[model samples]
Each structure stands twice: as structure tokens, then as C-alpha cells.
Target chain A: MVFENKNSHWIDPYTHKFKESFKDINLLDKKKEYWRFASPSIWYDKFTLKKFQETRSSQSIKFDVTNYNFLRFNDGILDTETLRNFINKNKNVEICSFESIFLKKDHWSSLKFCQAQLNAEKSYERPLALFNGFNAKDGVFIKFKKGVKKDLHIIYEGNNKKNCCIRNLFDFEENSEIKVYEHFYGNSKYNVVSELFVADNSKFEHYKIINQDISETVIYHFFGNCKKNSKVKTVNFSFTDTPVRNEINLYLEGTNCDATVASMGFGKKESSICDNTVFISHQEESCKSRQIIKNALKSGAKAIFQGKIFVASKAQKTDGYQMSNGLILTDDCEFLVKPELEIYADDVVCSHGSISGTLNDDHLFYLRSRGIPLKEAQKKLIQAFFSEILDEVSDDNIVYYIQNQISEILTL
Target chain B: MFEIKDLHVNISEVEKKIINGINLKINPGEVHAIMGPNGSGKSTLSYTLSGKEGYEIEKGDIELDGESILDDEPDERAAKGIFLAFQYPIEIPGVGNLSFIRTALNSQRKFNGKDELNPAEFLKILREKADYLNVDMEMLKRPLNVGFSGGEKKRNEILQMALLEPRFCILDETDSGLDVDAMKQVSKGVNSLRSEDRSFLIITHYQRLLDYIKPDFVHIMAKGKIIKTGGPELALEVEDQGYTHLLN
Candidate 1:
């Protein structure tokens, strides 16, 4: 039995595929190639299929989002009142739940297109993403109309829930531009999956802030499909004290597409583990992709980065680059990096580099010789190490928030 | 006001002695130059005075104002007004040149129990000093010496020295990578900082720089020791001939 319900809506067939795929996944497989640096047993033991009761906590939203369209989710459940208010205010954009979008019939093609993209090749092979799909409930669907420019804020706040799962789908139409800010807060074992579809000549910018409690765990998966002449940029700033994993997969399926995925993470406690796994595929000719990952680790913390760029046989003139840098502050901490470039095309430009070391002694001495104390000089260099990624962020408020978070983690 | 007595320094890793029994003294308002060939331990002496690690002082005492400062850290020594313009200025990416200098200034001020200057006040003073040294205001906005030309990097070191206004300054091979024009600009900057209460220890391999800065005393160093000490004429003699005659 592929699915328990046969007479359900279109979502049943889409989710049934994932349910079948989940049966073949073994989360406890220690010898898994992708999970070599980071053991899967840690998150596998913490996985829970039992859903938690939803709570009503509107006051938990801490960030100032008064200038943008905001959506708040408490314990994996959306606030219907806030969604309705946003839907009423924004007429050009179509925002609704997956179930409601299926009934619209006008958006059925878009849904099918996204599902086909996900089903193509090995895109949906990730076990955690499959688990999220298997247990997926109704998720929000946002479609930006042609040439629409707007900013949207999504807040995921948990009320001490033991386990929760969330899925969000974004469809960017041709010539449209949108910036989405996703903030994850509170205490919970969260498994989230976000799927994005960028049409021709469209632009999509994604910014994520993951600041969960020290006792909880977070596993996030991002899948982006970029079409002809589209541009997609995603920047993730993670300052979590517990085990957190971010897996990003982007496919350049059309010519002249450009995609950039960058992340900066901080881990300080013994239990802190931050992992970033990225795979970018250039299937079409003349496409470009960049992956930049950096992390600062202290105490007994550990961080891992596994990034790969694949250029297909037909992907001539393809440009792909990957860089992973780690700064280890203490003797006990560890940073593991694996950067790979697999190109089947002869006329492609592809490169990757990985470096992990402590703060530079010469730089420290130079600063200290100018009268800056040892501790302060260290902090300044660490801050400067992460500033390259911070300079890419445009929003002042988000930058300020991230700076404060970095300072707090450093002080700890 | 600055002195090194019976200073014996060994490379910490291999314990190979580099400075074998060196003694030097410089009173206030005097500029002293140490001219040496390659591998003569000139830079090591400067680094030792500035409290760089990896140099073991087997038998020595560095004194400032009649107080021993062998136990102080680099920053503590800086607060006591000891500065070393590195032979190769370290390149720190993502740290603005202006901000780094300002931080250094404020840190020294705070350590001396004086008030720190805000950005506006610091920028005003930095602009005035930077202009006098022929430093482009645009360069200060970039990361410190990251992609700067050799001349630009040397000039930046002088800019930092001017901003800190240290009483005891040590220039280690400051003329190694500078062109004629840049050398003059840097010499002018250093000359402007010379005052009645300040002293300098200029370490170089040539006498061309000494022609501009005009050191009061010249010492010829070879084989980890000073072989000859004389007035300014000693530098002219070394330049006219070489260190081989002095060593003989």
C-alpha cells in the first residue's frame, strides 16, 4: 500500500511517493557515505514521529517585522488569522495553504511542475527530507506574480514541543523578485523542508536565522530549482548551541542561471554541532554556481562542511566554485571539511578549496602590538573572519541581530 | 630612556643563540641606527624589544625609563610606549586600516588611564596625519595591507606609528620595500614625529634611509654582535665600503 488514503486530494499522491521512499531509508546506517564526518546515529536517536500539540503563542515573535508581510507558526501550525490578514492586504500575490491551492485548479500546473522537479533524478533521496514529507501536514504555498517585488517574514516559534515538522513551498514567477526572511526560534526538535522554484529571469533571495535552544535539535533541508536566466541566493546564519544540520541542494536546469549559497555558523558548547552539506548541479550550459561555508568553533564543539559541485557532460562553459573555511579557537574543538568538484565536461571552470586553522598568530601579534589586549584582539579577528559573509547581507536590522548573536556566543 | 643590557636571545624552537651579548642605550631625543648584513639578528633585536614570542632571553634585561619590562606582554609594552614597525607588516583581511589604528590608539589610551576618542574625533586626527604622509584617504577604508602595493604598505606602517605617537620607536627594515619617493614620504613622517622626549631605533641594511632620517649614532652589527660603534660618519663608511671591512 503506497498510501493509506486513495480518494484524497492531489497531495496524497505526491506525499505517497515520499512515504514509499522513507521506507527504504535507514537513519541508523553509520556507513552512509554522506554522513561520514558526522554520525547519523546522533539525530537518528532523537527522531520522533509523534506529533506535539499546537499552541497559541503570538507574543513569542521577537524580531521587529512591522515593515514586511509576516507569518507566524507556533508548534508547526500556522496562525490562520495572520495569514488571512496578509492575504487580504496583498492582492497581487497568491498565498494559501497547500490544500486550498489544490482546489484552485489555476495553480495545479505550478504544483505539478514543482513535484516533477522534486521527483526528477536523485533530488529527493535525502532521508530527513523524505521523513518530513512522509509526516507532512498542510503547508503554506506562496506564489509571486510577475514583476512583483516584496519582502516576507516567516517566524517558526515552538512552545517547548518535543517534536515538530514544517514544509514551505515558494513559486517565483517570471521577472518577479522577492526576499524571504525565515527565523527559527524556541525549543523543539524541528525537521523543516523548504522547496523553491524560480522561473525565467526571476530573482529569489533567502535569508535564514536559526537560533534554537541548547537542548533541542534542528534539521533543515532546502531544495532550489533555477530556470533560464534566473538568479538564486541563499544565506544562512546559524548560532545554535545544539546539534543543527543544514542540507542545501540546488539545480541549474536552464542556461545562464546563477546560484550562490553561503552560510556562517558559530558553535561553542561541547554539545554544539553544526553541519552544512551542499550539492549544486550544473545541468545546462553557461551556468554558474558558488558555495561558501565558514564556521567558528570553540570548546569541544564540532563543525562539518561537505560541499560538491557537479558539471554535467553537456554543461559547457560552466563555472563552479566552492570554498570552505573553519576557525578553531580551542585545542579540543574540531572542524572537518570535504570539498569536491566532479566535472564531466572538458570546457568547464570548476574549483574547490578547504582550510581549517586557528586564529592567525601574526595578525594577532600585529593587533596586540598596537596595544589591543589578547582577548579583545582575538574577538576582533574572529569577527573579521565572519565579516566577509556579513557584508553580503543588505538588511540593517538583520545584520544587527546577527552581530549581537555572534557577540553573545563569543562571550559565552 | 631606552636601554638593552647584556641581552642574549635564542630562537625558542632550536635554542640557537641569535643575539650574543648585546648592549645598547639611547637617551631621549636621539635617533640610533643599527646597520647589519643579512642574518645579523637586527630584526630579532627589534622583535625582542617589542615582546614578540618565540625568542628566549637567556641573559638580558630591557628597560624603559629605568624600569625592567621583561615580564610585560606586547600590549603592556605598547602601553608603556614601545612600538616596532615590522619588517613585513602583517596583512589582516576584513579589518579596516582606519578602524585598526583607532582601536590601537584607544586601547593604548585606555591602558594609560586616559579617555578614549570616539570615531569622529579619531577620524579627524587620522585624516590630518594621513594627508601629511601622502596616504590616500581611500586606502584607509580597505582591509589593512591586504592588497596594498609595497610602497603603500610601508607608508601605512608609518601612518600607524604617527597615530600611536610612541616614545620609543623601532623601525625594522622599514626601507626594504619602499621606492625612492615612498622612502622620502615615510622618512618625512618619521622625522615629523621626532621630538625632545621621543627616541628611535632604526634597523636597516643601507645608509640611504639614514641620509633622510639622520641617525645620531650608527652601530655596525655582524655575527650576532655589534663590531663597531661611531657617529653618523660610521654609516657613510659602511655605505662607502661594506660590513666586511668593519668585521675585519
Candidate 2:
């Protein structure tokens, strides 16, 4: 049975709308350009939406999330005790579950706040996004007041036979700044959709990590809107060999908006895949966007990167740049990259580049001639290849965490 | 001791002969110089000894310390105490110079069952040798051979040679692109490393380098064969009259 918010008044309307959008749509359409390298059949054939209940068991894998403001979704059910304790201790920003926030009818301002924020248009063109919009049972809603600063953490674990759909909406008012770190991993299949709204003069930084093992699959979709003088930066790391499909879209609706998207992917296991697709639209004047992606694929692994930038006719003085580099460790590994730009403005600058090659023979010989073994030499070069993107992360905590995680994957 | 016996090699792709029936021997503490014109197989012999790929060995063997090393990989040959200073050092981006040297040194030591040096100890040794070669400290921090001038590259090669301290060293055109003063500094660094248990094979096109490093035997090679062998005077003879006079 699909998840239903029976007791909550505010979210009941969206649930009905989600069910309406889910019917009469084909989820396995292969003709779509967005599904060129990835076939929806592979996902549909491998996973099912089975009803699962939380078992109250400890997490099999653990990461230190104590120091940061943390929340956990164990087997698709929110740990209410943990969430309540965290909320009581840190009341700087209003944080609560979507159910708790919408259950009461007398919270006039709260309902109005969420009604305005959560009612942002949901895209029906994508089947997975439509499914997630309707079936998502649990998620967190964060509301940041004007000129507020906050740090948030969200964790999603798909344990056992559970299939969970999560939806998150972040609303940042004018001059507010916020940073969020999201971690997704586990054995169950998960479909996640996030929508962010950055008001004028505000800033948002989103760092997401997908680190599932070979037995899991994650479908992630993100859509964001930036207003006048607002900025948005996204840094994603794909460390899982399991097939991960990532789609990101950002729209600059106001003047002087800026956006940056960067990602690092390492395909370490057999038949591992990381597919990333991004779209950025510039609708106003004096906006800028930058994209940098790098991938290192070992034997039997594949990586795909597709990115496009669109500049409207009135969006003059736009500056956009994109670069993608791939390193294939063996002949068996595969890398595919497609970077494009569409600009209608005459006074704009846009550039895109894609490069893929195996390790340089000269570089290998130089290392080996100095007495380094061949395997060690290749490892060192692979590490160097990834450092180009990893070094760009500005947050110390995230950088340290990512560095350790990357070392673990590469060394194995 | 290092010995080469009736060595014949050909370029792998074209199957053209480069080193034909070459024989030479060098005892410990002795320095031998091979002077040849271009296409005379001086660099080919050096590459063959260092086990570079694409050079097919058709006949004969090379022995170090009484055992043949012809079947070893390039890195294995390096671990067996063979060092080749290339005429043209390659530039490897994203690898620090000092870090590369340290890895090389420890790899060889590990093969020989010797304890590896920690970073502090490694830095101490590198600084001393680099200072002796007049190498700037900043150069060690840059990527290997990237943006290095000709003189700086040669000096860096010498610095590596000093740190490795191999049993057999081959300097293939080490003085090709250096000015007189830079040549002297390189020769001085090389001269300081001479000892009773180490051997040197210096290849050059002129006698100017031998004026400082003083080889015990000088061999003239032409058309893939060593034509003559004599004392230091043979180098002077080639420098004065050129290889055409020696050919006749």
C-alpha cells in the first residue's frame, strides 16, 4: 500500500495530488534523452515497493555524526526521540517532521509558512520524481527566518527489504545562510527528491554523499531556485559501485545569481555505474554558473556525465564554464561525457570541455624506474587524479570526511 | 663488477640493428667513457642495460655482481643496483620531486631487506645531496621535471643519482645541454660519489666532460660497434679531429 498521511491536514492535499500524478504515466520510457545511457527497466526490474517496518536494530555501519546537528531515518521511519532531542537542544531554526508540523490546525503562521514553501510546482514530466512526490512517507522540513544562520545534517538508511521515498524542502528567507550535509546509503532501494528555495540575498550550500554497497541502488533528483543576489553551491561525491542516477536542475530567476556544481566519482567494483545529469538555466542578467566533474574508473566500471547550460536572451553578462575529466584505469573500464551550452544572449561567455584517457605510459615508467611497483604507481596516479576535485571542497569537516572515505575506496 | 658480453639488440618495431656485437667490462672504482656521434647506439646501449621496453635483445647478456640481469624488469634492474640518467628526463605532473625520490629510495632498500628511512631521515639526506649539487630547495617542492630549465634538470638528475647511490651508474649524455660552469658543478657532484665499490659509465659526444671526470678507458663507437679503446688521450683525439678522422 502507498504511504498515506491520514492524520495530517496540511500534507493531505499534496498526498492526493501525488496519487493523481502517479496514475496513467509510463515509468519505463526509454526514448527520453534524459534516459539515454540509463534504462529505467534496469531499475524497475531490480527493485519493488514493498511495505517494510522498522526492526529497532542498530545500524550495521556507523559514521560519527555526533558533533553535527543530526537526524536519522532508520528503515524509512524517522527516529522521533533523536529528532525531538536535537530539536529541543537547538531551537535556532524551526525543525520538525512533515507529519508533526502539518498535524495541528491552529498553527496558523506555521501552516501558512509551509503552505507557501511546500507548494512550489512539482515537475510531472519525470516518472521517478512523480513517484517520489506521491509516495514519500517521511521527511524533514527546515525553515530559516530572515538573517538566520544554521547547519543541518540528514541521514537516510535503507535497511533490508524496505523501499522508501523521501522528500525534503528547504526554505531560506532573505539574507539567511545555511549549510546541509546529506548522507544516503544502505541495502534497500531509495528514491529521494529535494527542492530548495533561496530567497534574495541568501546563500545555500548542499553536500550530498552516496556510499551504498554493490547490492543497493539510489535514484536522486534535485531542483533549486535562486533569487536576486542569491548564491547556491552543490558538491556531491559518488563513492558507491551500485548504480546511482543523479539529476540536478537549478534556475536563476533573479539578477546577480550564482551557482556552482561539482562532483567526484570513483567506480571501484565490477559493473559499477555512476550517472550524473545536470541542467542550469539563466533567466536574468549578470548570473554565473560553473561545473567541474572528474571520474576515475577501475576495471569493469563505467561513469557517465551529462551537463547543459541555457542562457535566455535577456540574461546578458552571463558567465558559464564546464569541464569534465575521466581516467580509465584499464581497457575494460568505460567513461562517457557530454557537455553542451545554449546561449541566446550576445554578451555572454560560455565554454565546455570533456576529456577521457588511460594512464600516461610515460608517467608510469617514470614512477616504476624509480623502484616503485607498477600497482603502487597506478594507485598514486589515481589519487592525484581525484585530488583535483577533492581539493576544491571548502568545508574542513566535509573535506576531512571525504578524504578518509576516498582513501578507503581507492586503497581497497 | 659489471660485464657485457657480445650484446646485440634491435629496435622492436622496425627490427633494425642498433647495438651490434658490443663487448665491454668495468671493474669497481673504474670510470669508462663511451664517445660516439649520433646514431652510433650510445643511448641504445644505455637503454638496453636499464631494461627499457621496445629494445629487443637478440644475443648475449649483462651481469652485475656475477649474476645475469637480462631477464629482469626495469624496476627490478633498478633494485639490483643499476641507474640510468636519461639524456632527456620526462616531466610528470602532480608528483612532487622529493616525494618521488623518497619512494624510489625506499623501494630499492625494501627489495634489499634494508630498513626504510622515515620522512625526516629522508629529507636530511636529500638536503645534503641537493645542496652539494647546488640545487635549490624550492625545486624539490615542484612537480617532477615540470618547468625545470635544462641546467636545473641535469642537476636534479645528478641529485637523484647521488641519493640512490647505485652500484653501477650510466650517465647518458649528462653534459649535452649544460654550459661550462653548470657542467663543472655536475661533474663535481658526480666526482664526490666515486668510491671503491661503485662503477661509472659516462657517455658523451666531446672530451670536455672527461676533462673533469677523468675516465680510465675511452671507447670510440661508430655504426653500432665500438671501434677503438685507449686512455683519456682517445677522447682528446676525437675532440680535436672529429669522428670522421677516426672512421678512416
Candidate 3:
């Protein structure tokens, strides 16, 4: 169901642990909030406390709710009376902006329940100024299901003069898959931190296409987890996210786990940067991980890629590869890639490679000799260069779409 | 239809010249064989005629059809009906042979105010032409010259020549990499496209090709300058004496 608030649409609050099994239980008070932007492990605290109190009848620590709370409500910032009206509309459901809650009334919520819980919500305290302004009022909560897949596309556009935090709880179950193509396109701009969580044997393919059209700097934080035999692919296609940062930390807690990180970005004019920092743990044997990043910079634009891979002592027989290739279109177009691999297991196979270069003159002339004009010749060469990676795109149609984009970048 | 008068070329960035005081003329429907020893600037002359960059033309005039074509770019020269089948044809990835031919043909046609051919129509016409040359459709679809054997690349060059049908075609060591059968087949293709308004300038160090496509006139180039000009029988004499008698 589509949520059209008729006014505003922010992230909805969800309060469910995203997985069935838990290694730790939280001993915190229900009213207290953890540190701002807790690490991946602190998430266990949020999950344990909510699962303990929410299920009244079934004392079982395991529950799912997003599979049922697939209902749509108005999203976005609202005035005092408007928020009051929204809460009144969902009076029968446990509607709290700060806490992760599960309403067993919609299929969407039920889908989340199958993963681990309905929603694992994080509460954000609003500033005194946001009470009158449009900051806290615009936040929203969306709960997804276990088997069904949906696209959450957004253009984070318009003028943003204040700070606002957006939260979403996407819970999945075993033997389920979902793809979320989220785009963070802003015209005026604001900072956003979005988090996605997946359960064991469940897969989440997330694509964050960020475009920077803002006068102010924007930072986007992403936190995700992958369970045993689960697949998670995250892509960062950003055009100068003026300071876009994607922080992905995944835990392969089960044997035979697989995860991949692929990213492509372009920076133009006076230092546009993206820090793709990732930490994938090979906690079990027979896990595999691959990371690839391609960057092309122009007009003195700057880019940075910092990637980390870890093979735990017990992660024997694991396989991993990390690579980053970049092209500096102009002499001043600066690009730097830092890739690291930390292995504690002696039986693992891991490698990393990086390369940067300009266009080839001989290749250019060979095309010209065949009578292709200059621009068209570059298109062919560049297409051939990027095709190595683009051919890996799962969809043939998407390959053509990206080919056209490369053509567009060349034409400009 | 091609003439080079007082031609002087420098292959390096310095003022030192490669071709000095060269003068030659090639008429329509005539096969001009340029037999030169190694380091005689045979490749330089071909590239200069095709307007390759970094080669400084110190002095001279090159005329095609009575018009001075010295200032033209390579593609422009190509558009003006000039084709060069290189000794070592460059490989261009992602450019199919058929599309490359069609693009070259259409560019020339557009230069002369003609319409372009669509892919389907171009493919039909190309298939017919390739059949005449005994070429395959697979070669047309693959990237130009990529993964092609030496003889296959030469055949591909000839196929490109047939597709473009330029007014003045230069064969730069086209016979070097071909076997007897390939040389015969390529000669047959060229002979089929022979017309009164088109000319061939075949550069070779050996005279074996003269047996297939008999040249009407043969010019011997020594140290970048033409030292002897004769009929097809001169090729026979060069094969007999191996340029030793010509130098003497």
C-alpha cells in the first residue's frame, strides 16, 4: 500500500527484532534511548527489550509483526494538531514515533514479523525548535513483509534548513527475498541516516542512488546485517553526494554465508566525496564476500573509497575479493581508494586490487582511422571500458539504461 | 587521379625529414606498384596521404582528382574517397565491422549529400558484398580486427574496402600477411570492383602480387623518393634483380 499523507511523508517507526535467533538480551529501561546511532551490536539491546514486553500471551522471545502491519498511514512532518489527528486515526494500533512497535493488522507488518519481529524502531528526540518547525513532524514508519518485495524510491528534495533523522525498520524471514531501490535525490538538501536489517536465510538487495543538488552538505549513513547463507548487495550510485557516506556493517554469523558490495559514483567540480566504509565479518566457515567499486572523477572533483574485510579465526575456508578501479577524466580530477583486508584464518583466500588511468591515445586513433568521429569514438572506448562491469548487471534492460547514461555523460 | 609533387615528410618532432624530394603521379584505372626497400618511408607516405597526426609535411602538394588535398584530416580524407588498408590494421573493441563499414560509408555519403543506410538495409547490402568477397557475417558482427588471424584481418581490410568503394585506395603491405589463396581471393575482389574512376596504389617489397593483379605502371622507391617508373615488366625485373640492379 502507498502512504500518501496529503501533506508530508517521513520514515515510519518500527519496533521488531529483525531475526528469529538472538545471542544477547538487553537489560535497559524501556524509557531510555541508546547512544546516538548505536553500533550493529547495540541493536541487540533494542530487539531484546521490545520482544520481552510486546508479546503478552506468548512468552516466546521470537515474534514477527511487519508481515501483518502492511497498513499505510500519512507520512511526513505535521503540526501539533496534525500529528494528534494521525495518532487518533490509528488509535487501536500501538502508534509511537520513538519506539519500534508491531501492529498485527496488515500484511506488510506480518511480512516483517516473519523475519524476526514486526519492526525494530529507534526513537529520535526532537529539538525544541523542531516542535514548531517541520522536522519531527515529517518522520514516518514503514513495515515490510517476508516473501513480498517492494521498492522504496524517494527524492529527498526541497529546502531543509534544520536537522531531521529518518528511521525505517525492514524485517525479513528465512527463505524470503526483497529488493529495495532507494534513491536519495535532494534539491535543497538535508542529512539522513537510514538503516536496513535482514534475518537469517533472508536476502535484501538494496540500491541507494544518491544525487547531490544541494547547496549544503549531505551525509547518508547505512547500516545493514546479513545472516547465514543470505545475500546482500548494496550499490552507491551517487553524483557528488556532497558528503555522502554509506556505512555498511554486515555479520555473517552462519556457515555458507554470501554477501557482495558493488558501488559506482561520479564526482564533479570542487570536491564532491563519498566514503564507502564497510565491515563484513566472516564469523563462520564457508562464507564468501566480494567488493567492487568504480569511480570516475572530473572537474577537480574528489572521491574516496575506504573498504574493510574481516575473516574471523573460525571463518576457515572463506573466500573474498576487493577491487576498486578509477579514471581521472581531467588532470585535476582527484581519486583515492583505500581497501583493507584483515584475516585471522589461515585457510582463507582473500585479495585486493586497484588501478587508475586516463584514456588511451592509440585506441582513439584506431577508431578515428576507421572513420568514427571523435566523440563517438570515445563513446565506444568508454563503453568498452565500463562494459566489463556493466555486463554483470542482472538485468539486460538496466545495462542498456546505464549504457545510455554513459553516453549522456560523454555527450555532456 | 592522385599526384604528389616535391613531397617532403618528417617522421620525427625534429626537422629531420623521412621522405625528400618525392614526385609521383597515379592515374585512374591504373595499379601503381611502389616497391621500396625497408626504411624507404613507404608506410610514412601512406600515413601522410591519409593525414595521420604527428607526421609533419615539411613541403609539397598532394592532389586527388586535380584538387590539392593536403590540409584534410584522416577521416576527412577518408570521406573524400580515400581508403588505406594498413599492413598492421589496428584493433578497435566494441566496434562491429559491419557497423564500422556502414558508418564510414554513411559519413562519406553524408559528406557528398547522400542518405544513410539503416542497420537492416545496411546488413542486406553488406551480406551481398561479403558474399562476393567470400567473407562471413560473423566477421561483420565481431569487433573490428579483434581475434582475427593475420590473413583474416587482411581479408577484413579488403572487405572494408569493398564496402566503402572509395575513389582512391592504398594497399600498404596488404600482401605481407596473406597466403597464396588469400592473395588470389583478395585480388579477385579488387578486380571485381575495378572501375575507370577508381585507382589502386599497392605498396609492397615483393612482386608475387603482380602476377595476380597486374599493375599498369610500377615505380621503384629508394630512400623515400621514386627512382624508377616502368610497366608491369618492371616488377618482373625487380623480382629478378632484387633492387640490387636498380640501386646500381
Top lDDT hit: 1
Mind giving the per-residue lDDT tens digits that candidate 1 earns over B43-94?
8898899998898899989999999999999999998999999889988987
- lDDT (C-alpha, whole model) for all candidates: 0.83, 0.80, 0.63
How accurately is candidate 2 docked according to DockQ? 0.55
Query: Taking the true A–B contacts (Cα pairs closer than 8 Å), what share appears in each candidate?
Result: 0.84, 0.53, 0.42
Alpha carbon lDDT at B121, candidate 1: 95
- Residue A316 shift from truth in candidate 2, angstroms: 3.3
Model 2, residue pairs in steric clash: none
DockQ ranking, high to low: 1, 2, 3
Off by over 4 Å in 1: A1-7, A44-62, A99-110, A113-124, A212-214
Those runs of model 3 whose alpha carbons end farther than 4 Å from true positions after fitting are A1-179, A184-208, A211-224, A227-236, A239-260, A274-292, A308-323, A341-351, B13-16, B94-103, B138-145, B175-189, B208-214, B232-248
How do the residues B80-118 of candidate 2 rate in per-residue lDDT, one tens digit apiece?
A: 888888788888776778778998999999988999999
Docking class of 3: acceptable
lDDT of 3 by residue, A3-79 (tens): 22322222232211211122132323343232222222222222122221111111111112123222221222222
For every candidate, the chain B TM-score is: 0.98, 0.98, 0.96
For DockQ, the strongest prediction is: 1
Task: Encode model 2's per-residue lDDT on A290-366: one tens digit a residue.
Answer: 98888888878888888988898999999998999888877888778778798899999999998999888767876
Error of 1 at A119 (Å): 4.4
Predicted candidate 3 versus true structure: per-residue lDDT over B1-248, tens digit per residue: 89999999997666567898789888888788899889888988998888888788888999988899888877778878888888998887656666667877777777778888888888888888889889888877888788988877888888888888888889998888788998998888878878898999999989998888888889899887999999988998989889878887
